[model samples]
Target: MTDPLAGRVLRGDRRAVARAITRVENGDDSTDLLNGIGKSLGRAFILGLTGPPGTGKSTLVDRIIAQYRGRKMKVGVIAVDPTSPITGGALLGDRVRMAQHTLDSGVFIRSMASRGWSGGLSGAVSEAIQILDAAGMEVVMIETVGIGQSDIEIMKIAHAVMVVTMPGLGDDVQVSKAGLMEIGDIYAVNKSDLPGADAMVVNLLSMVRDMKGRSPPVLKVSALKGEGVDRLFDAVEAIRGRFLSPAGEEMRLRSVRGMIVELAKKKLLSEFEGRAFARSVEVARKVADHKMSYEEAAERLVDG
Candidate 1:
C-alpha cells in the first residue's frame, strides 16, 4: 500500500511532514514512510550546532534561518532541548527565539526533548531529519541540547558540526576542558560585542591551528545584534562541498556504519528492558541473599 502521507511529504506538504515526524517520535512503525522517502534522504545539508548552555545557539540559529530564507531556500531546524526528569517533558522553548520564522512555510522548526538519551541527542533525530529532507527542505540544521565534553555524538551524524561559544564562559580553558575544540568543522564566537570576545576568538584560533589537516575557521559574530552573520553563513555554506566529495563518500560510509551499530544497540536495549528488568529483580534478590555473585548474576542475565 502506498502511504498517502509519503506522497504529501514529497510534495512538501507541511502538515504531512509534521505528522510523519510525530509518528517517528512516538516510536510508531514507519516502514512505509521510510521506504517512500528512502531515495530523498541526501538532498538536504545537515548542519549541527552544539555548545554549552547560554551560548546563544538558539539566537544564532534564528539568524541563520533568515540568511537562508533571503536566498529563497527552504530550511528545517531540529532543536533538541533538555528533558525534564520530573515530568519527562521538554519546555521546547528554542522556537521562542525563532518566532519570526514560525509562520513562514519556507521554514520548518521542531523541538525535540532529549528524553534522557545521552550524547545530547534523542534517538529520533535521524528519522526526523529524513522526514524534513524528504519534504524538500534544502537545509536542515540540528541544534543540540547544551552539551559537555563527552557529548560528541553529533559528529557521527552531521556533515559538518559547528561549535558555538561566547565570552564570559571561561573561554579557552573551559573549551579545552570540555574537549570541544577538536570536533568542530566551524567555530563561531557569538556575542562578539562583549568585552572579552576578541581574546576568545584569538585563543580559539590558536587552539585550532594545529588541528591536523583541517584549519577550521573561527569567526566572530554577535547573533543578538546580527553582526558578522553573513560571513558566518558564508563560512558554513562553503564547507558543504567537502562532504559531497570523494573523501566525503568515505565519511558517509563510516556514518552509515555507525548508524547501523546504534540501531542494533537500541534494539537490544528495548528487548532488554522488556524481559530483563523483571528477571533482574530475581537475580538481585539471589545476590542480596548471598546465593550468587554479582559477576554470576550478570552472566546469567546476558546468557538468559
Candidate 2:
C-alpha cells in the first residue's frame, strides 16, 4: 500500500506527494507509513536554507529550483513559515514568492507552519524531507523561517546548510545573534545589487579567513536577476562530493537521533504534568506564599 503511493509520487503524481507530506506532517498513525517510505529515502540530497528575513531566501530557493530544472533534476521544497499561534496555520507569504514554479512538473513545494515549535521550524520537517526523498526527488530543500538563534537546527538535518545574508541590516549583529557562521556550510550574500554589498562581502571574507580551516565557502548572488546562482549550485555539488561519505552520513544520523530523543523527552514530561505534578497556579501560590522556594518546588515536582 505504501509502496504504491511512494511509486505514484516518484512517477510525478503531485497528489500522491501532497498526501504523503500531509501524513508525515500530521504524524497521525503514520509511523508504519513512514517506515515503509524510509526505505526509499537516503538517496536525495537534503539542502537547508536558513538566514534572517528579507535576505531573499525564497528568491534564492526559486533560482536553485530553476538551475536544477535546467539539469532535468526533480526538486522538492519545504518552505517553513511563521504560524499564527491562535489559528495554527501559516501566513505562507514565502510560498507566494515562489508561485512562478507552481506549474512546473519537476518541482514540488509545500508550505509548513512553524506552529510554535521553536528551532526556527516545526518538528515535522525531518519527516517531510523523508517523504520528499522517498518520492524520488534529486534534491530536497528545507527553507526555514528567519527566526534568529533557532535557525541553527537546520545544521542537524541538511547535507549542506546555506546561510543567506544581504547588505545592510547590521549583518555583524545578525550573525552574532544567530551564531550562523559556526553552523553554515556555505554563506550566500544575496541581493548583491544593493549598496554596501562589496563591504559586506569583504567583512564576511575577513571573518571566514579569521576562522581559517573551519569556515565554509562564501558566494555572492542576486537571486532576482539569476546572477551567480550557477556558482552556488556548483558549490553545493562540491560540498556534497567532499562531505557525503559514510562518516558524514553517520553524523547526520546522530543528529536525527538527538532531535528525536529531545522531542520524546518533552512529550513525556508534558504527559506527566498535573497528575504527577502540581498545576501552575498551585506552584505559583506556594511560591507567592513562601511555602516553598522555586527550586524546592521544582525538585518536589520532579521527585513526585
Candidate 3:
C-alpha cells in the first residue's frame, strides 16, 4: 500500500516524474500510480502537436512553453522522438532546441522514444501526460514523433490537435493523401514568413471547408520568429472551450467515449502480445506463402 510515485510527483519532483515516464514507456502496468493520480487529473490542459518529420514541431512547442510560462503557468512537455535503430534510444531526444528552459523550474520537458510504436506517440504517452497533470502542470504539450501519416493517435489524447506544417512542403497533396487533413482541431502553417506560406494557409482552409459543418481555425505562424504564436495559443483555448461549452456537450461526451474505447483497445493489445503471439507470426508467414487466405489466417489467430 506504499505509493512513492504519488507523493514525489505531486511534490513537483522531476526525478520521480522521469522514473514514472520510463516505467510507462516500457509498458509497465502502473495500477498503483494510476489510482494515485486519479484525483489529481483534469487540472491540466493536454495539447497535442503532430505532423511530418520536418515540421519544426519541437521549436513550436518550445515557443509555446515560453508563452505559457510568461503567464506564470507551469508547463510540461512530452516530446516524442524517433527511436534509434541500434540503441533503441530517442533519436533527437531531449529537444536541444528547447534547452533554454532547462533551468526553469516551472517548465518540465521530457523526450520519449517511439520504440517502433505507431500513431505518433509512444505507448506511455497518455500516462506521462497524466503524471504531469497530477503534478499541477497547468498546460501539458504532447509533441509526437512527427512521422507524418502515422500521427493520427494524437487525436486520442489531445483536447485539441495542432497539425503543424510549413510552406514549400507541397503540403496540399501530402496532407490530403496522408488523411491528416481531417484529424486536426487546429491547423498551423509554420514558417509563414517564407514564400508560399500564405498559399499553404489557403490550401488548408480549402481542405477544412470541404469537411462541412466543422469550422476549425487554420492560422499562419512563424514559430522561429515568434509571429502569430499567441493567436495559436488563443485558438487552442477557444477550441477547448467550444468542446466543453453548452452547445457542444455532445462533443465532450464523444471524447469521453473515445477515450474509454482507446483504453480498452490498449488493454486487449497488451493481452494479445503477452503470450503465444509468436503463433501469429507463424500463421502470417503461412498466409504470405499462399497456403491460406487472410480471412482464414485471421480466424486461425482468433482460434489460437
lDDT of 3 by residue, 1-304 (tens): 5377888988888888888887777777787876787676766667888777667677788778778778888999887767421111232234433343456778777777765664314336767877898888988888774555435664566777898999988767777766677778889998898899888988889989999788788899988788999999899878667755676666655544554566666666777665547778887889899998989987887788
Name the better of 2 and 3 by lDDT: 3
Model 3 quality (TM-score): 0.82
How accurate locally is residue 118 in candidate 1, as Cα lDDT from 0 to 100? 51
Q: What is the C-alpha lDDT of each candidate?
A: 0.77, 0.72, 0.74
Candidate 3: deviation at residue 241, Å?
A: 4.2
lDDT of 1 by residue, 1-304 (tens): 5678889999999899899998877778787887798776676878889877768787888789889889998999887767421111122244443453456789888877765665323347777888898999988898874354324664567777889999878777667666687778899999899888888888889889977787989999998788999999988888766666666786566655654555556557767877887889999999999999999998899999
Judged by whole-model lDDT over C-alpha atoms, candidate 3 comes out at 0.74
Q: Candidate 1 clashing pairs?
A: none
TM-score of each: 0.85, 0.80, 0.82
State the lDDT at 250 in candidate 2: 66
Please report the candidate that would top lDDT against the real structure.
1
Which digits, one per residue and each the tens of the lDDT, describe model 2 over residues 1-304? 4646666765657788798778756645565556666666577777889888768787788778878888898899888766421111222344444443466677788877766654314346777777787777888888875564445664567777898999996967886567777778888998888888788888888877777578688898988777888899899988667446765766557556744654464445546664555455677689999998999877766766
Enumerate residue pairs that collide in model 2. Answer: none
Q: Pick the candidate with the highest TM-score.
A: 1
User: Model 1 segments beyond 4 Å from truth?
Assistant: 1-3, 83-103, 118-121, 146-151, 245-247, 278-282
